[model samples]
Target: MTEPAGRPPAFRIADLIVAEGPEGAERILIAGLTVTVSAGEIVAVLADDTGSAAALIQVLAGRRRAQYGAIDAGGAGRSRRIRPSLPAGVSVVAAHERCPDGPAHVVVVDATGTRPAESGAKPAHAAARRGGAVLLVTTDAEVAASADRTVHLNRAPRPERRPKAAVRFTTQALREAAAGSLTAAGVDAERAALVARVLVDADVRGHFSHGVGLLPMYLDRLRQGGIDPTAEPEWSQEEGSVVRLDARGGFGQVAADLAAERCAERAARTGLAAVAVRGNNHVGMLAAYREHFVRHGVVGLVLNVSGPSVAAPGAGRPTLGNDAVCMVVPRAGGSPLVVDFATGTVASGKIRHAAHRGERVPANWLVDREGRPTTDPEELDRGGAVPVFGGYKGLGVAVITEVLAGILAGGTVSPLVHKQRAEPERAMDCSQLFLALSPDAFGNPPVEELLDVLSGAVAAGYPQGPPEVHLPEQQERLAETMAAEHGVPVPASVVEQLGWGAVRTAPATAGGTA
Candidate 1:
C-alpha cells in the first residue's frame, strides 16, 4: 500500500540500550531493546516502572537522546525538550483516568496504579482511530490484543530491595486491641470478643489476607448500622437434622459458631445434621467453623459466598463471588483431615495486598475487562476479574453453594447479593450452609484406620522433599504450636489503626489449641 501524502513511514527503533554510557553511569535503565510501530498500527511495551517508561517515551518523542542505538521517529523532527511529561500529540493515561483530546502521534496507557483510579480506556482503539501508533507502557501481563507487535526489553535485573521495618505486637495484646476496638465500634462485648478471636486466629494461621486487614471496613460497617452489634441469631426453623438460623445481620463469625454448636448437637442425636445461616456478616475462615465439628469426631462441611469480586471464566465481566468450601474429618490417631479453598482463581485479598505493596500478581489469575491476561492487581477494580478456579467446575461449585446456602436458607442470592459487598451496618444478606455427619450413624468402619493407611502411603512417597509430608491440619497445628510458644506478631501499623498505643514487647499467651 502506498503511503498517504506527507505521512512519514512507520516509526522504528533497533539495537537500543538506554544507560548513562556518556558519563559516570550508575546503572543501566533499559538494555537490548527493539521496537517498531507502523503508522496506523499500535504496539504495547511492558516495563517494570513508570519512571523507566517515561524515559523511553521521551526518547521516542525526540525529547531525550538514548545512550546507544537508533530511533527513526517517522517524520517527527528531533528536539532536546526536557518535558517532565510525555511530548504533545502523545496521550498518557496514568493513575488518573483522564484522557487526551484527539489521537496523537503516540499513546501510552499506564496500567500500573491504584485500582480505583483506573478507568477502562481503550488506548489501542483510540490510537488506531486517528491513524496513529500506540505504545502501551505497562507492567501488566498483557496489552490489548489489537497490538501489531510487542517489544520486551532485556534489562539486567535490579537488586532486591529490603522491605521497611514493621511494628510488631504480641498475640495477646493484638487480640485485646482488636476486641477493644470492635467493642468501641459498637459490637456487643461477647460478639466483639468472638470476632476478634476469629480475625486474630487468621493472622496466627498465616492467612494475613483474611486477618485483621478487614478490621477497618468492619468498623465502618458498625458505624453505618449495617451491623447490629447486639443482634442475636434465632433458630428460625428446625427439623430433626435440618436447621435455619437468622443472624439478623450480626457478625457472621458468631452466626457460624452458633450453627456449628447446633449442628454438632443435632448430629450427635440424628447422626447427620445441617444448618443454614442467613443475614450474616463476615465469617472470616470456614476452617474455623469446620474445626468445631472435627473436634467432636464428626465429619464436617461448610460453604459460604464471599464478595462478588471474581469473574466467571469466559464471563467477559466480573460476575462470580469468592465462594469458599471447607471439609474436615476426625482421625483417632492424627489431626483431622481438613480441606479449605476459595473458588476465585486467587484470593482477592492477595491481590488487594499486592496492589497495596505495589507488587504484580500472577498473570494467569486475572483478566481485564477485555479478557486480556493482566498482572496488574489494579485491574481488578477497573472492570477486570479474577478467573474462576478450575474453570467451569469452580463456577458450578459457586452456583451450587448459592442454591444450597443462599436460596435454601431463604436469604439473598441472584441479583440481590450478586454484586453486593458486605458493609458494617449493611447486611451481607448472604447465607451459609454447614453439614455434620457422625460415622456412628452408618455403622462405618474406623475412619482413623483408613486414614492412617492413606497418610502412610502419602508420607512414604515424600521423595526426600519439604522435610516432612504433612497433611492439612498437621502443618497448621505445628505452626500454631510455634506461634503459641513465640507469640504471633501483629503489624504495628495494624495496632495503631486499631487505636492500640504503647506497644509491649512481652511474650503473649493468647488463644491457641493445647
Candidate 2:
C-alpha cells in the first residue's frame, strides 16, 4: 500500500480489523490501505458523516466488528486490538467542507461557547496555522484552500454489516436511551420502558432514520426551550373512525405512540380507526409507531405532513410540504413488515446532514440557481426547494396528505407555517394522521391467514421486470435479518468524519475459514 510521506513505515501496513460482539477478529486484506498520518498534516474526507461511514470508522479502528476485511497495524500478536484513544497530537475537525464564515477556529466544547463565538475564530485559525494538525471534512467546492492531503471516502458499494453480539448491544443501548428520555420526562414506568423498547427495535430493524441519531434532536429541543417534556396529548373525538389530538408540544415519540395505540385500540373495537395529531415535534421513526399496530395483528397506515421545504412538481418553486408516508403490516414469521418513505426525492434534514459532513449530493436530487436541477445543498437554505418524485402524481399525494393531516387535524399549512418561521424549531408545526385497521375485526377469519394468502399470491404473481413483489414491507423485513446478524453497516462518510482508527483481526480468509 502507498503511504503518505510523513509517518514511519510501521504505521503504514495493509490490513483489516472488523469489530464483533464479545470479541473481534482480524484479516490481512491486500486490498485495504494503511495511510501514514502525522502531526500538522491535514487529512480530508470528501463525503458526509452518515451512519454507514460512522460504523466503518469504528470497525476500522477495532471498536466494532468487520463482516469481511481485516487490519494489521504493526508487529503484534493479534491485529484486532485498538488503543481506545488516539495518540497525542491528533485533532479532528468536521469543517463540513463549506467555507468558514471567517478564520478557522476551535469551537469550545462547553455549553457557554457551544456552537461558535466571534472571538474564538482567530485563535482557532492561528492554532491550526501554528502546525496543529487539522482534519477537515467537506464537499468539493467548500474548501477554500488546498489541504496537505485529501482522502476520498465514498458510500459502501452495497449495504453490509458485522457480529451478532455487537449488533444486539448497540440496539439495546439505543433502547435504553429512548427509555431514559421518556423516564426523564416523567412518563410512567411501564410506558417509558415500552417506548424505549420500540425505539431500539427501530435500530435493529435497520431503520436508522429513527434510531439513536435522533437523540440529539430530543436533547437539543429540550435544552433549547422548544419542546415540553411534561406536556401530554389530550384526545378529542372527530368524525366516525377519526380522532383529533393536541400534543401540547410534548415529545413527538410520545404523541405518536399514544396516537397509534389509541387508533389500534379503536380499530379493534370498530372495523377501522383514524387519528390526526397536531402540535408535536419530530416523531422519531414512524415505523416504530406503526409497528405497534402490526404486532397486534392490525395493519397500520400513517402520513406525516411537515413544514414547507418541498417544491411544486416540475415548477421548482416551494409550494407543498415534504410529505412522508409510513405503513406497517403484521407478519407471522421473521421481522414485521413496514414501509416508510419521503415524498420528496430526499428529505431536507438529509441535505443539512450532507452539509454538516462536508459532502456533495447527487445532482439529480437538487435544484439549480434558477430553480433547475443541481446537487449543491446550500441552495436549500436560501429559498431553494427539493423536487417531488413521479411529478404530479407525487405532488397529488402530498396534497392529499396536507388535507388529511394538516387541514383536518387543525394544524398550519405549509405556506403559512413557512411564512412565520423564524427559527428551526418554529418550522415544525406540521401534522400527521394515523389509520389503523384490524383485519379480523372486518371479517370473522383470522388476520394472519389472510395475510399469508395475500403474501403468497403477491410472490407468485411477480412482475416480469427485475424487481420482485413480496408484500410492501417484506423487503425491509428480510434486510432486518441480515442487519441483526451483523451490526448496522454505517456510511463511509460517518467513519472518516469521526476521526477514529481501525485494524484487521480476522484471519486472511473469508468466512473465518483460514
Candidate 3:
C-alpha cells in the first residue's frame, strides 16, 4: 500500500482488543496497522477474542472515526454517541468475565428477572425457544467456503516513517462500492446500498449482528439472485392507526425504521399508533427501531417474525421463530431503558462466536442433531435446535411476536426453508410491526415527572451495594463514563485479534505536525 503524500506521520494507535492463552486472559495493545484490501473489497480478520472481532467490526462499519487517517464509510458519517442508555445486556459479557465464578450466575439471575425470587429456572432454561433465522459468526474459512465472499484481514507492520494522513472512504463511497459489487454479481444497486447501509451501521453501533458479519450473506444472496436492487418501500395508509409498508423485500432495517418513525408520529397525535411492514428483508437490531421511539419520548414496542429458525417447547423441530421483541421507555440522565433481546437462550451470533474461536458452549445451551441437550456447538451450527428458555413461557413470547409482527403484517414462516427469490434479503417474507404510545396521550403527564416516579421507586426498592438495582440503560451510562474518562477497557484478546497492540507512551515523531 502506497502511503499518501502530505499526510502526518503515522503513530501506532490502539485499534483492536485481544484475549489470549488458555482460560482467556485479557489484554489491550496498539499495534501498527494498515488496510491491505482494496476499496469495495471484503476481508476477514482471523483472530482470537470475539470482542476484538467486534471492535474490528467497528473499524469496518465506519463507527470509529479513523484516529490516524481518513477511511471511507459509505455515505453515512461517524455514529453520534447520543449518550443514550445501552441495551440491558450490553455489558453482560464483560461483567460475566469479571464476576466471581461461584455465585455470579445466581446473582445475575436474581437481578435480571421480573422479581428477585423469580428465578423460575436457570437462564439457560429461561430463554424462549422459538423458530426463526439466526445470524451466526464463523472463521474466515467457513465464511469464505460457505458464504459468498470473505475479506481477509491480517496484521501488517506499519512503516517506520508513517504517512501524515491515511486516505479513507466515506459512507457514500462504501455504498457505491458495495452496490457496484452487488450489481456486478447481478444484484440491484439501490437495494444493495440500502442493505449495505443497515449492515454498516450495525458495526457503527458496535453490534456484530447486522454489521460486516453479514457481508458474506449479502454476497450470497446476490449470487443467488435473491435481492432486487431497485426495490423500495411501498407505502400506504390503511387507517388513522395503521400505516402499511411493503419493502418490496429489499432491506429490513430501512423498512422497519421507516415504519417505526411513522408509528412514532402517529402515536404522538393519537394515544396509540401501529405501523406494519411486510416484504422487507432481515432488519438487524430491533433495538435501533426502539431507539427512534425513545428519542421521540414515545413508549415504543416492536416485534419481528422469522420462521422455524428457533426451537419450540416439547417439540424437537424448530417450530417457533427467533422472534425478537424490543421495548424502549424514556428516562432521565441516562439512556432510555432499552430492552433488546431474542427469545432464545443465546443468539446464533454468539454460538458462531464460540465456534470461530474453537470453543465449546455451555452444555445446557445446546442440543444434539436430534434436538436433545448437548454441549456440542457444531450440532447446533450444522442443523440443530436450541430448547426454549423455560419450556412454555419462552414459547409463549415467540408466539406473540409471530402473531403481532408476522401474521398481523401478512408474512408467513412455518417450516424453515432457505429460498432463492428476487425479493427481500432474508427469510421468505418477513414483517415488522411497531407500536408507539406517548405518555401525554394517556393523561397529559410530564415525561420527566413520570420518569422520576418510576426511577425513584425502582431505586429506593433496591439500594446500592447489595446487587444495586438499576433501571435499564443506567449501567451503560456508567460504563460509558468510565470509558470516556479512563477509556474503553480493551481485553488483551481483542487487541491481538485486531492486530493492533496497545501503546502507553508517545513515540518521537518525524517531521510531522505537532
Backbone clash count, each prediction separately = 7, 47, 64
* Ranking of all candidate structures by their lDDT, best first: 1, 2, 3
* TM-score of every candidate relative to the true structure: 0.66, 0.56, 0.55
Q: Please give, for residues 1-514, the per-residue lDDT of candidate 3 as tens digits.
A: 2423343221111222222221111222112223322221222334334444444334333343322222212222222211222222211111221123221121111112222222112222232111111111222344333321232332333322221221122334434444555556655555566565665444333344344445555556645545544567888666767778888766566678788888887787787988988876677777666556866778998887765546776455656666678888876565677776677665555555445444455544555566554444567656676666666888887777777887776556434423322232454576788889998888867777777787777667754532432555554455334333332222233223332232331122311111
In model 3, the runs with Cα more than 4 Å from the true position are 1-197, 200-207, 332-334, 411-427, 446-471, 474-514
Please give, for residues 1-514, the per-residue lDDT of candidate 2 as tens digits. 2334654322222222222221101121111222343333444434443333344444433355443222332212233223543333232222221245533212111111122223233333443454444333334424413555655444344442321211123344445545666566566666567656664555566555455444445455566556666676888665687889887776676778888988887887787898888887767567777656865667888988776778876566777677778878776775556677777767666665455444455544566445654445677777778788667898888888788777887566656543222353442565789998887776656656766777677666766633543456655665565555444433334323322124122222212111
- CA RMSD for every model? 14.2, 19.0, 21.4
Q: Report the CA-based lDDT of candidate 1 relative to the real structure.
A: 0.65
Greater lDDT among 2 and 3 belongs to: 2
Among the numbered candidates, top TM-score falls to 1
Over 417-496, each residue of candidate 1 has an lDDT whose tens digit, in order, gives: 52323344467777788999999998977888888798788787777753442566665676566666666655544555
Q: In model 1, what is the error at residue 69, expressed in angstroms?
A: 26
Scored by lDDT, the top model is 1
